[model samples]
Target: MSDVPPIWYEFRDAVYCGEFQVAEKMLRETPSLLHMANGIGETALHFLAVEDDQRGVDWLRTKGFNIDTKNEFGTPVLFEVAQLGYKELCAWFIENGADLTAQDRDGRDIGEYLLYYDKSEMADWVRKLGA
Candidate 1:
């Protein structure tokens, strides 16, 4: 069996725990770790969505990470951020060309999910973007 790199696990854990500083250090030391996924197929962006860190999101976006990458569940980064009512992150995703119409594994569109979560304002904003 091939030995798994310890830094990869550390990077994934740091992202999950919102330790952007540590994650960044790990990325700088081992750029290949940036592509590593968690058990749920979640990348650093997915963890950022869970942590709701706008700064971290902005930093990752600046690093040219794929904004629309889907997790194992088929949920896009923007969808997760939107579901959490992260207006700024959602707006950033929109500005950066995230696929607003992308759906999750459950067939729920981002706008539909926003409406379901009682975030009609965000849903309306998404609708306006498409118009």
Candidate 2:
């Protein structure tokens, strides 16, 4: 049996399926949902990252969701996007001031994670940002 709530699945599904309006309505109706984490401590932002939903991420940011919010493993949304090689979304996060030096629980930086995940292009892009 999963420790995650049923509504969490619904919410994650809504975001993953690109049903932004449904996600928005759900969030508005249950504001606490934003703070709710699933079994892995991943919030809706993690789902948005997985789907590469930059606009949805921006919307959530405006709703006061922390860009640096970490999951149980201490991986922030930016770090997740970086390793996934979502250049555009990662760039958007960078432009919007996502923490560049954020480390996971193991103290591995985003660049290292990117490189380890074979996202050298993303690693280069991130390096250029700091240059």
Candidate 3:
């Protein structure tokens, strides 16, 4: 069996399935898991963004989750959502003061990365935001 903890899988599954209640319960039980990483190196906040779970994202932020944190690939929270065409999530971060021009390790800004992912429309929008 994998040495990974059982709660780890539970949390990941909860986020994957959009079971915010289950995820919240797990966080309530073991609050530190909020910032803990899964096997693939995604924190609970990352999953929340991936799912566009606004409530979960807000709850995590209230718990002190760093919105500026990077994933295993050095993708920031804002960039991750923007690349997914999550306009609401992108606007939330941008309006809330995320660096508009923050680049990944490869030096690709948000617009460039969106274009790289073939999200031409999103790239245009991000560029319009001057990010």
Q: Candidate 2 clashing pairs?
A: none
In angstroms, how far off is 49's CA in candidate 1?
Answer: 2.5
lDDT measured at residue 106 in model 1 versus the true structure, 0 to 100: 85
Clashes of each: 0, 0, 0
Q: Which stretches of candidate 2 lie over 4 Å from their true place?
A: 16-21
Q: Worst 10-residue stretch by lDDT in candidate 1?
A: 1-10
Q: For every model shown, what is its TM-score relative to the native structure?
A: 0.73, 0.83, 0.76
TM-score (C-alpha, index-matched) for candidate 3: 0.76
What lDDT tens digits, residue by residue, belong to model 2 across residues 15-125?
Answer: 667687898898888888788888889787776776798877777778777777888878888878877778888888888888887888888788887787888888888
Candidate 2 residue 65 C-alpha distance from true site, Å: 1.7
Please give the distance, in angstroms, between residue 23's alpha carbon in candidate 2 and its true position after superposition. Answer: 3.1
Q: If both were scored by TM-score, which would come out higher, candidate 1 or candidate 2?
A: 2
TM-score of 2: 0.83
Which digits, one per residue and each the tens of the lDDT, describe model 1 over residues 1-131?
Answer: 43556666676567666687887887888887656666677777677766777666667767656778888878887877877777777777788788867888888898887887898887887778771
Candidate 1 backbone collisions, by pair:
none
What's the lDDT for residue 28 in model 3?
86
Candidate whose TM-score is highest: 2
Q: Which regions of candidate 1 fall more than 4 Å away from where they truly are?
A: 1-9, 12-25
